[model samples]
Structures are given as C-alpha cells and as structure tokens.
Target: MRTLTTRAKVAWAVITVVVLVWALLPVVSIIATSFKLPSQLNLGTFWPKTWTTTNYEQIFAGSAKDLFLPALRNSIGISLIATFVAVVLATLAAYAIARLDFRGKKLILTTALGVSIFPVISIVTPLFNLWRNIGLYDTWLGLIIPYLSLTLPISIWTLAAFFRQIPWELEQAAQVDGATSWQAFRKAIVPLAAPGVFTTALIAFFIAWNDFVYGISLTSTSAARPVPAALAFFTGASQFEEPTGAISAAAVVVTIPVVILVLLFQRQIVSGLTQGAVKG
Candidate 1:
C-alpha cells in the first residue's frame, strides 16, 4: 500500500472530521432536544438549560405511551418479518445466480438495480387503493408487503455478489462426500455466508424500520403505524405547545434498537461489507 505524505494525511484527517461532524450534528441535536424540558426548547442553546427526562417519560409512561409503544412494536414486527422473508428468498435466488450459468443471469442484477432506483412515491397511491380493496390496508401484512418491495431487490443484489465470491469447491466437496445438494448448501454455503447474510438482513431491516411513506400513507391507525408515522400524532402538553420534545424522545427510543444491533454485530457487519462484492 502507498503511504500518504504528511500534507495529504492532514487533509484527509480534516475531511474525515468534517464529515463526521456534519453527519452527527443532527443526531446530537435531537438527543439534546430529547433531554430538554418542554419549556427549554426555544431557549436557543444546543444543550438544555434544565435537562430533564420528562420527554422520555411522556413516551414511555405518559400520554404518548399509547401511541409510541404500539408503534414501536409494529415497527419491530414488520421490519423483522420483512427482513426474514427477504433474506430467505434472496439467499435462494442469489445462490442460483451464483452457481448456475442459466439465461438472464445479468438481467437479474440489472433489474434489481432498476427496481432499487425506481421512485417509491409512484406506487404508493396505487398500493393504497389496492390494499383497501383487498382488505389489507392498515394491517401488518399490508405494510410488510410494501416493505418487501423496498428490501428484496437490494438484498438479492448484495447476496448474489457475496455468494459469487464464495468458493464453489466447498459446496462441491460436500456433495461429493455423500451430502445432498440441500445438505451441501445448508452445511457448507450457508455457514460461510452468515456474515454477508446477516449484514444484508440488517440493511433490509433498517430500510423497513425507517420507512415513513408506507407507514404513514398506508396505515390509518396505531394498529399498523410504525414509530416514524406515530411520531406525527403525538399530542402536546397543552394546546399552546408543540410535541417536539415528546417526538424527539420517541425518535431517540426508536433509534436505540438500530444502534444496539450495530454495536453487537459490528464485526460481522464490517467483515461482510469488506468481503462482499459492491457491484453486480
């Protein structure tokens, strides 16, 4: 590897620090806002004058609890379900693409790229009407299906790239040693692909978890509304006040699962990202 000169190193360091601050400033601001007392919002300070946990209490144990907790549960369930289904289906499709040199192999990757770039807004209105007619509107299944459309294409693309890099000899060796094709895949390929699979699942889950368009446009009630959507309905302490603090608290709470997942799986995530192919 080429070593950077002193001047180049300093420039890169400054760029890294600037990017970090740029990306993290909003998160830090929201966290600070979440800790502030309702009256301290417009105090024009980055940190609260009188820091308090009232916002957290409101979301967890007070008036907004009903809206926040149920939505949290819905977001978790729907995202997990979507991730699981997407990973399973994508794994199979990717394995086929990786091992088989059948027709349209390149076409599959091209289509996934196209679907990923397609505008999501264009489909929402049509989905809204279709769900209503099919009796799926405002239901967990309704949201989950839309989430799949957002997640599956990318999942397939990532896993296919990763799967292609895995040594074919491993699976072939297993099959030659009396293992069936399914056994070879389950016992050999799946174990080796765990990191990539897990990383893909986490990415898919985040996509579904953070979704607001489907969560807001498709669902009408707390029954199926995710946290992002539920934040819109938080009531204020009084008619004169906005629910900014409560909303901030709910946002912080919703972000915790994502943070924890990353912290716990950072190793696998980094490994997968580095080892997997970045493009079709």
Candidate 2:
C-alpha cells in the first residue's frame, strides 16, 4: 500500500472525526438527556448541572403507570418467540430450497422473495380480521404469527443463500456413511450454518422489537403492546407539556439491551453478512 501524504492524512483524520461525531450525536444526546433533571432539559445545554435518576427510579418502582418495563417484557417475549419460530421455519424451508431438487423450486423461491418485498400495510387489515375471528387478537400467539410473517421471508432468503455456501461433498460423504438426509442436515449442515442462523435470528428479533405500527394497530390492551408502541403513551396532545426527559430516559433504558446484544454478536453478524454475499 502507498503511504498517505501528511495533508491527506490530516484530511482523513478530520473526516473520520466528523463521521464519528455525526454517528454518535443522537446516542450522546439521548444519554445526556436521560441523566438531566426534568426542569433542566428544555434549557438546551450539552451537559446538565443537576443530574438525577428519579425518572428511572419511578419507572422501576412501578409508580409510572405508563412506564416501559411491562412493555419491555412484552417486547422481549414477542421478539424471542417470533425469532425462534421464524428461524426454525426458515431454516427448514431454506434447506429444502437449497438442497432438494423439486418441481416449482424456482417458483417457491420467487414467491418467498416477493413476500419479503410486499408492503406490510397491505396485509394488516386482513390479518387483523383473521386474528379477531380466530379469537387470537391481543394475544402473544397472534403477535407471533404476524411477526413471523414480517420476518420469515427474509430469514428464508438469507438462510438459503448461506446454505448454498455449504459444500455438498460433506453431505454426500455422510450419505455414503449411511446417514439419512435429515440426519446429515442435522449433524453437519446445521453446525456449519450457525453464524448465519444467529444473524437471521438477531435481525428478526430486532424487526419484531422495533415494530410500532402493527403492535399498536393489532393490539388494543396495554398487556399486549410492546415497547415501541408503549413509548407513544408518553406523548401528550400539546408539544410544550411533553415529558422529554422521562421519555428520553425510558428510551435509553429500552435501547440498552439491544445495544448489548449487537456488541456481543458483532463478529457473528459481520461474518454471516460477508459469507452470504461472497458465497451466494
């Protein structure tokens, strides 16, 4: 590699600093506001002289009826269940698409891709009616099914791409050793596809977690609503009276788990994304 000139190096450093600050500004602001007292927030300062965790305390103490903890629990439960179901279903479907030769295989793949691209709003009304008729409305199962609909297509496509990267020779050797196709898939293919599966699960989890429209539209009771929808309760009709500090504090708390998960699995995400791109 050619060495950079002093001027170029200086310019590169400035650009990097600018990009870093741009990326982190919102996060920094959220954190700063989380610690500020309610009175000091609208003053618009980078740092607050008086800091308090009273907002967080009220939330944890269960004093705030509109607090996010219950919503957080609901979000976590729905996201985990949805991700699990989506991953399993997608994995099996991807295996068949990738490894089996059958009529309409191309059509199946195309349909899955088509489903992935379709606007979610188009299906919401019908899905809501269906759930209501089936007596599944406002239930975890109801949410899980819709969440799966949102996540499944992408999960199938991503896993199918990753599955194509696996060497067929391994499966062939396992077959020669008297292993059935299902056994070979379980023993060999699944192990090799762990990273891709993990990435798909995480993506699906985040999608389910972040969804506000469907959660709010489909679920009427606070018991079933997730964090994103629950956060909307913090807003008032009048802008001037909104609890910006409490809202920001709740947001900070809500975002922490996701941040921790992403940081923990950063390597797996990078590996899986690159593997899918290069191999597929």
Candidate 3:
C-alpha cells in the first residue's frame, strides 16, 4: 500500500482542522451565548463580556421552567418510545428481508428508501388534519406515529444491510440443535446484531428528538408539545427583556444528552455503519 507523503499528510491535516472549525464554530457560539447575560447579548462580541447562569436559571427554575420542563419530558418520552418501536419493528422486518428469499423483497426495500427520502413538509398538513379527526392530535401517540415515519424506513434500511452481512449459518446451527426459530434469532442473531441495532436506535432517537416540523404541527399545549416546539412559545419577561439567552440556554440543555450519547457510543456507531460481521 502506498503511504501518504509528508506534504500530502500536512495538507490533509490542515483540511481536517478547517472542517472541524467550520462545523464547531456555530455550536461553540451557541454554548457561549447560552452563558451570556441577556444585557450583553448585543455587545458586538463573539463571547459574553461577563458570563452568568441567569439564562440557565430561567429555563430550569425561573419563568421558563413550566414550559421548558414539560417540553423536556415530552421530548424524552416521545423520542425514546419512537426509537424502541422503530428499532423493534425494523429488526423484525429487516430480518425477514435479509433471511427470506421472498418475492417483493426488492419492493419493500425500495419503498422504505422512498419514504425515507420523501419530503416531510408535504405530509405535515395532511397529518395535522387526520390527527385531529382521529383524535391523535396533541398526544404522545400522535407524535410517536409521525416520528416512526421519519425513523422507521432508514432503520429498516440500515438493519437490513447489516442483517445481510450476518452469516445465516449461525442461525441454522442453533435450529439444528433443537432451538426454535425465535430462540435461534434471539440467542444467535440478536447478539451479533447488537451494535447495528444500537446504532440504528440512536439514529432513530436523534431523528425523533430533533424533529421540529412534526412536533410543531401536531401539538399545541405543553401537554404533548416537545422542547423543539415549545421553544417557539418562549417569551421575554417583559417588552424590554430579550429571550435570546433563555432560548440559547434551552438549546444547550436539549443538546447535551445527544452529545453524551454520541460520546458513549462513538465506537459502536462507527462499527455498525462501516463494518459487517467477520465471515469465515
């Protein structure tokens, strides 16, 4: 294999650094803004002249607490439920697609791809009306169902690809030993598919968590409104007080969990997306 020359390596390093800065600059700015006192927001500085936790307090315990807290709970509950359901359903469907030599397998995969790429905006209006008529509006189930639309297709695709890479012989061996089909899948296939399932679960969770379009259109009251949607309801204490700092603080609060999840599972995510099970 040809090794990278010193000059080429240096060039690659520079490009990497530049890309990192470009990607992280906005996030850093948001974090800094979250710590800034509202009074210093328009001071023409990249960071606050004097930092304070007043904004954080506003969201956690002060005026915005009622809105932020409930929304936060709704977001966590809805996203987790969506991820679990999507992963479970996707795992079963993908296994069938990969393991069975049935007709319409290609059609199933293609339909999932199409739904995953479909424009979400086009469907929101219809969903809004249908949800209201069907009495799903402003409810957790309402949001979870829409979230499945956003998460399920990609999940099916990801797990299907991963399942195809898994050797079927392991499952056969288990069955040969008198294990039932479910037993073979649960004991043999599931253990090997863990990394991929975990990665897909994370992806589904993130999709549901960050969704603003569905969250905004489907819900109204804080009873079911998620953080992404509740942010739109944020108001200043008075005409003079700006809500920028509070909004930034809330953004940071919601973002931390996602960052932590990525940090904890970075290895599994890379493994799932980039590698398949080793074949003998």
RMSD per candidate (Å) reads 2.7, 3.1, 3.2
Over 178-246, each residue of candidate 3 has an lDDT whose tens digit, in order, gives 999999989998888887788889877888899999999999999899999999999987878878999
- Could you tell me the TM-score of candidate 1? 0.89
Please report the TM-score between candidate 2 and the true structure.
Answer: 0.87
Model 1: runs farther than 4 Å from truth?
1-13, 175-186, 263-280
Question: What is the C-alpha local distance difference test score of each model?
Answer: 0.88, 0.79, 0.89
Ranking by TM-score: 3, 1, 2
TM-score of each: 0.89, 0.87, 0.90
lDDT sort, best first = 3, 1, 2
Number of backbone collisions per candidate, in order?
0, 0, 0
Q: Write the per-residue lDDT of candidate 1 for residues 161-217, one digit (tens) a residue.
A: 788778879989999999999999899987888877888898888889889989999
Model 2 clashing residue pairs (backbone): none
Residue 199 error, candidate 2, Å: 1.2
Per-residue lDDT of model 2, residues 81-175, tens digit only: 99999999999988898889888878877787787678878878898899899988887787888887778877887788888878878877898
Query: Predicted candidate 2: what Cα RMSD to the true structure?
Result: 3.1
lDDT at residue 200 of model 1 (Cα atoms): 89
